[model samples]
Target: MSLISILTPEIKKAVTLLFDANIDTIEFQATRREFEGDITMVVFPLLKVIKGNPVELGNKIGTYLVENVTEVQAYNVVSGFLNIVISADYYLDFFNDVKADKQFGMVEPNPDDKAVMVEYSSPNTNKPLHLGHVRNNLLGYSVAEIIKASGKKVYKTQIINDRGIHICKSMLAWQKFGNGETPESAGLKGDKIVGNYYVKFDQAYKGEISELIATGLSEDDAKKQAPLILEAQQMLLDWEAGKPEVISLWKTMNQWVYDGFATTYENMGVDFDSYYYESNTYLLGKEVVQMGLEKGIFEKDPDGSVWIDLTEDGLDRKIVLRSDGTAVYMTQDIGTAIQRVKDFPDVGGMVYTVGNEQDYHFKVLFLILKKLGFDWSTNLFHLSYGMVDLPSGKMKSREGTVVDADDLMNEMMQTAQTISEDLGKLDGYSEDEKTTLYRTIGLGALKYYILKVDPKKRILFNPEESVDFAGNTGPFIQYTYARIQSIIRKADFDFASKTFSAGEITLHEKEKELIKVLALYPEVIQNAAVNHSPALIANYTYDLVKEYNSFYQTVPILGSDDENAKMFRVQLSKKVGETIASAFKLLGISVPNRM
Candidate 1:
């Protein structure tokens, strides 16, 4: 049981016995560095019910705890705080209990609990995955893992935007550009080649717009009359009509993009349990719109566009379908959400991992779902995150200035290799081993750097800083894990097989601090899951590593003369290593045994 769980009821009882007051809640925080206590309780809240001086009240509660609770060694009243020093035996007992359990912080999912489906990396098929997609994937994937660790069954999913005018543009560009070139023929990943055509489409479409503008057309009219765009629009119509040639080309190009996306997903260390395609789902909400119209949830204009007015709910009217009987993005999203719950009947909630630019969109979507009477609407969460900017500037996909995901990952690996070589820590490693370690350190740095920040805050990512071996960087935590592994390897005795008695050796201050932090892992995981944030887990792991490093430097493990003390320290070190690995796993980062 956690310290809070143990002390809450006891503290309530103390309040009742001493002041005849019944309190329902207790607020506890970590003891300040100068305070001689493990946990500090706020005595001011008790003032609301019991009228007395705060310090005197704190002393009374402290005396009660000391007399009734064996774990309470001593207490000091500082202002309105009751700082209680717990016995060394409590921490030692905690360490001993959890030392042998490898999966100490992870909880098993309850079979009766509802599952969650997380959607992320929902990239359009017209372009390859980019740096923005990287953030979405990492956040979504890490959130899913954290939720799973907190004991919920999670399904990772994405919606591929495969059918649209944008997709038609890429197809038309590919068709217009000379000798038919396939991914194999172009010697490029399928997505890369398709992305090149997307750029090409933009180039030709711009030239046509310029010509039209020179003929005295307004810019907007020029853009609309651009021959390339007109052709792309016709191509989209052909695709929708199932024209044999257009359908074949669409299938072929989409397959190429899919194959390319698979490779990138594998390299980037993200996966999905299921995928929804826009082509298959775009027409799904039309019947629902008709049903909404009949039920008066949605209103139709004279032009026949379907919409839901949410002005009274503090949002504007949202269009679900166009006057041309075509579904809007909102319609598709609505349909996709319902389809997922139908596909996975156990899914009671969903998390949409999209950029913050669509924050209002999700608000409208959720409200619409709720108004449409779906019971699961309340569980829908928008994991809206801020944009990631480079030191250079923001990226533009149409102009082809966006950082590609594959290229960024490769650059990270190269940066890791360069930094590791300069550090001179791989003297005895083989070539293949060095390569793998570089990738591990590189990807670890990238993921940790991004995941360490709160999702709502914009990131100014600097790759060089992320790979550093000091500070709160990934390599710093990873190096600590590796150091612990080295110590475990050097220990001559089997610490795992040993157990310590209650009074075998008194705990060091650093040892107690380490155990306290270790005890917080489960709570941290649950908190991270509840908030839908990976920054919590990332920072908590860093804290644990920092505490372990402090303990390592101040205390001797293998070098200790006392057998029991040395065994206990080594076992503690091993558990710390296991926890670092476990926590890193949730963040989709790999901790190397050596770095």
Candidate 2:
């Protein structure tokens, strides 16, 4: 059992000691920064049917909690709240227990007969991934890992946004302006090549629209009068017809983009069991529309466009199929889910790691799935995260300032390499080890930066606020791990000979706090999994590492004369490093032993 579960019985006894079994419900939460202990209770919330003032009630509860609880060192009555402090002895025992159990605080999954599908990093072929996509990818990857660690059978998948008029625009620009160029021929990344064409389409169309407006055309008239969109639409129609030349071109270009994406995904250290492409599923969307229409879940307008009426659910009706029988974005998602269920009938859940802007879209999608009698539809999750913005403003492609994922990764790795060299931490490492260390440090920095914030909160990307090597960043935690490894190497101590100490050592304040935090790692993962937030785990690791560092600074460990103290610190540091590394792994980051 996890530490939290083990403590529950003790907490219950404390509560039962103070009040009549029926008077108050014991509500204990792992405390927050504003609170005083590992567990805190607010008596004011319970005193609704009682007679005493909050502080008096708190004192009575506090007194009962301390006297009745074996693990509790003391309890304080602050205003209406009872803050229960765990004994240093008890806290140290808890930490030592955590350190001894070598699973690094991971618990076995509970019995649940449901499979989960987590979809993430659905990048469009028209452009490369950017900082926004990085946030989505990291959050999605972490959430899936956490859920899987919780004992759920998770199916990790990706849906490539490969088809649409947007893609057509790129193809059209490449066809009209270029004389048949390929990534190899141009010496450019495939995604960048495709993106350049997309940008060209916008620029060319903009110039045309502006000149038309100057020639007395209204704004709407200018856009409508322009033939670029229509040409793009025609390309889409041709694509749908399986035109040999257009199909070949699309396949070739998309393959390059796919290859480029695979490289990025590899560096990010996230993998999916399967992939679904829009080109393959757009037709599936059309079939779903027909099924919905036959079942009266949707209707066709005079123009023969199919739409679902969402008014009953307080949402606007959405068009599923156009008059020309083309599928919209939502239609394709519906098809993808249906195909996925058929492919894996045992799969009981699906998660869409999408931005919050499409909140309404997923809400409608889930509701529609339920209305269609898919019971597992209730298990569908939209892991909606907020957008990533630059400090200056929203990322604009027109300004040519969109941060390319590949370029950013290279820069981070190079920066990490330079930092490692300057720190003189790589003196004894081989060239290959140095390279691997750089990858670990670079990727760790990227992951930490992305996962440090709540997924639902907007983040401002700042190059100036890069991940610090000495502060609450990935490198900082990595350095701690490296230090522990260095010390372990020097000591040449066999881990197999380690023994548990009887009773608790009189630990310093930092040691007690660090132990308590370390003991809570399993619960931290469980909570992060349930809440779909990696930031919580990230923050917890940071706090634990910070405390460990403080302890290391205050106490000597390697050659200390006190055998018990030395062994205690060594064992504690090893476990802390292990736990921190495990946490980083959940976020798709790595820690290097050398640097």
RMSD of each: 1.1, 3.0
lDDT of 2: 0.80
lDDT of 2 by residue, 380-494 (tens): 9899888888766777663356888888788888888887788787778888888888888887888888788898888876542455687778888888888888777776665
Query: Candidate 1: which stretches are off by over 4 Å?
Result: none
lDDT of 1 by residue, 1-595 (tens): 7889888999999889889999989999999989899999998999899999999999988998889888899999999999999988889888889998978989899999999999999999999999999999999999999999999999999999999999998999999993699999889999998899999999998998899999999999999989898888999889988999999999999999999999999998999999999989998888888889999999999998989999999999989999999999899888889999999999999999999999999999999899889999999999999999999998988889999999999999999999999989999899999999999999999999999999999999999999999999999999999999999889877788877867678888899999999999999999999999999999999999999988999988898888888988989999999999999999999999987
Clashes of 1: 0
Worst 10 residues of 1 by lDDT: 495-504
Among all candidates shown, the one with the greatest lDDT: 1
Which stretches in model 2 have alpha-carbon errors above 4 Å? 1-18, 23-25, 29-38, 48-69, 109-112, 210-219, 225-229, 290-296, 299-303, 323-325, 398-400, 418-432, 494-496, 503-505
Give each model's clash number: 0, 1
lDDT of each: 0.93, 0.80
As a TM-score, model 2 comes out at 0.90
